[model samples]
Target: MAASTQRRGRRIMMAPEELDTFLREARTCRVATVSADGTPHVGALWFVWDGTSLWLYSITRSKRWAQLRRDPRISVVVDDGEDYGELRGVELSGTVEFVGEAPRTGEPCPELDVPERLFPAKNFGLDDMPHDGRHAWMRLTPTAIASWDFRKLGGL
Candidate 1:
């Protein structure tokens, strides 16, 4: 007797509620990009979910920002907060066009005195600071996104 197998195309769309859960589940993402000299760089970042977009902060002096300065295109990987079971993930591929130090997104950039201002008071302290020239803040706007939650798949 032969056994049948099931294979189906999985769409990468996360429902509004699912997205909220995923975003809340994962607060960190790794930003990846290539430098002007063709060097690869990746940095872990804390992000905020605005329902329609993802926001994060970076110091202009950071290597990640240097690479992004030359290449606006980048990738971000955010994973589920759980340990072994039910791992969900969100992968974002988009351009990192610089909008200057303006607050166009109404999202606060990382600063020495204050965090994104979105998190609770206990989320950050006055220890964070830009290393080099003190860039103050940065913003990354997402153009494309891919996310998956395996809750329905028994943790695929």
Candidate 2:
């Protein structure tokens, strides 16, 4: 006898609400970008999902920034799974647009502080943290998205 596949498809598919909830609670995403020469770079990033787009805060002098400036196309993966049945993830492919200049040498931008506000709260359950460096913020507007939940594969 064959196990049912109804739950399989449903589980793998995240409804709009489920997807938003998962993204809201996720801590990290693997951000992928390409260099001018076509080499690929992937880095784990702390992000904030504001319903419509993902906001990323990064050091202006980092390699990821350099590569992104050269080519803005990017892909991001947010997933977790210690076991097969628990696996769930989302992939967002898009282009990044710089939202604003890096903050002054030792100050924070009140408007672009989502990462500063969210990182601590989500990762450590804290509401605030000292601002770090001259950081720039970028917004990723996803062109396509794909997601899955292995729990759907249950009922076997």
Assess candidate 1 and give its TM-score to the true structure: 0.66
81-128 in candidate 2: lDDT tens per residue?
A: 888788989888878988655642435466556655775677678887
lDDT of each: 0.58, 0.77
Clashes of each: 1, 0
TM-score of candidate 2 relative to the true fold: 0.80
Candidate 2 segments whose C-alpha is farther than 4 A from its true place: 1-11, 103-120, 124-129
Which parts of model 1 are misplaced by more than 4 Å? 1-13, 81-85, 99-115, 119-122, 125-136
Best by TM-score: 2
Error at 99, model 2, angstroms: 1.6
Clashing pairs in 2: none
Per-residue lDDT of 6-38 in model 1, one digit per residue for the tens?
123154345557866776556688888897777
